[model samples]
Target: MSLEKKDEHDHEGWMEERDLTAVEERYLAILMWLDKRLRLVDYLELLEDMYYKVNLQMPKSHTEQYGLDNKFWYWYPLYALGSFSTLAYLIAAVSGALLGFYYAPAAAASAGDPTVAYTSVTSIMVDLNFGYMLRSIHRWSAQVMTAAVFLHMLRVYFTGAYKEPRELNWIIGIVLISMTMVFGYTGYLLPWNQLSYWAGQIGVEMALSIPLAGEWVAQLMFGGFTLTQATLQRMYILHVFFLPFLVTALIAVHIGIVWMQGIAEPH
Candidate 1:
């Protein structure tokens, strides 16, 4: 209980008294060192208590309590949608990182010539080994993640899982889905091809259409009133830097809330 460190021999004495093995002694030594500086032991004890509390027996689910396992099994696939989305997101993230090493986001157009970004993409597809498949996988995974997230939202809506205690999670889900769209849009522009160029133009127009903050949004997002190198640069930073951190943090919080609240069951 004392905050003051007892004699070094006291910890040693305690360990000796416990007849700890070599591994246990080393572990205790490291833990005590860390505890002295960080008081990690307190947090560890709190987590241990929470673990036991969570393990305490609880009433069974409505299906389990009512002996309706057969009916529950029919609906199990819906419950897996969230997990499917998470898996797709992870796959996209890994593949995107790999593709980023080879991607360029320049948009300096040359007459009858590919832009630097487009040429880089062409090189990846035509020259780099496995680059075509890697890019394809990344693109497909991103599309899959978007679809899975949409379906997951629909599942949550129809099941009433977003009601009552889950309203905050519902809101977070909305933000995450919007962010997913933004992620896709930004990545789509990184190639800076004809399609990407027009998409960036549309984004600028959309931003410029907002009533009061129109020009400001345009300047901040597209980097000018027109699609150019600055636009590509902004999209690249947003896709590779900003959104990844924001979305990952939001996903952790979203899942943490669900873990804390327990999954809502359709009764």
Candidate 2:
């Protein structure tokens, strides 16, 4: 028999010796099949290594270092804001992705009927099943994320957690907050409603007031000095494509740094 056949025969023999149940035997067979193609074992080993490094190298917090052993602490709840914001962000991302399955970005219209974007949104809310609930969850989660992130920033500032060793993370946090605002603004304009149109106008003016780069900023961000189809397209791209990847990457780095350095405690 060939080496391949020999190996397969050996695997079968090993399994038969174990007297495995039907489910266990099928599971092993599938595991071997996938492992042959995917090299999943190597990745699992790497993940295991990373898990140990995280657990072993993570520094103790002030309370842990001194063994305060207090049942409750005032600042403990404030420390949870960062995690709470992360949870909210995850909820928004998942709901937004589901919403994307039914949303359209086009803004074509005859005169003053309704843009394709608005119609799609209305259809989702009124026609599609459970669509309203999904949209509400996405909107509320985004709002909660914004509030939580703002409060987290304030907590960091008041606690002096932005100093020295954590300065880079602090800067990253600021960038994240700014991007969160951008995310909210882009999503707000997606519906193409009356309020969104005026909001887009405000954004155009703000972009155009940026000293030397005003016109360039306005053109790049809003596609022109006016709010047209291009403006909506730009907002859609920024909200769905650019911002999510950038923000998620930044968040991973931010959380990884915090994990490595340990959460900064108030002095």
- Expressed as tens digits, the lDDT of each residue in 23-99 for candidate 2 is 99999999989988999899999999989987896556677777654622667888899999999999999999999
C-alpha local distance difference test of each model:
0.90, 0.92
Q: List the residue pairs that clash in candidate 2.
A: none
TM-score leader: 1
TM-score between model 2 and native: 0.77
Q: Each model's TM-score, in the order given?
A: 0.83, 0.77
**Which candidate wins on lDDT?**
2
For model 2, the stretches where C-alpha displacement exceeds 4 angstroms are 1-60, 69-72, 110-112
Across 1-267, the per-residue lDDT of candidate 1 in tens digits comes to 799877865776777779788898899999889989998979999999999999999877777777877766788898888888889989999988988898877777655588888988989999999999999999999998999999999999999999989999999999999999999999988888778889989999999999999999999999999987999999999999999999999999999999988888767
lDDT: worst 10-residue window of model 2: 66-75
lDDT of 1 at 201: 90
For every model shown, the clashing-pair count is: 0, 0
Clashing residue pairs in candidate 1, if any? Answer: none
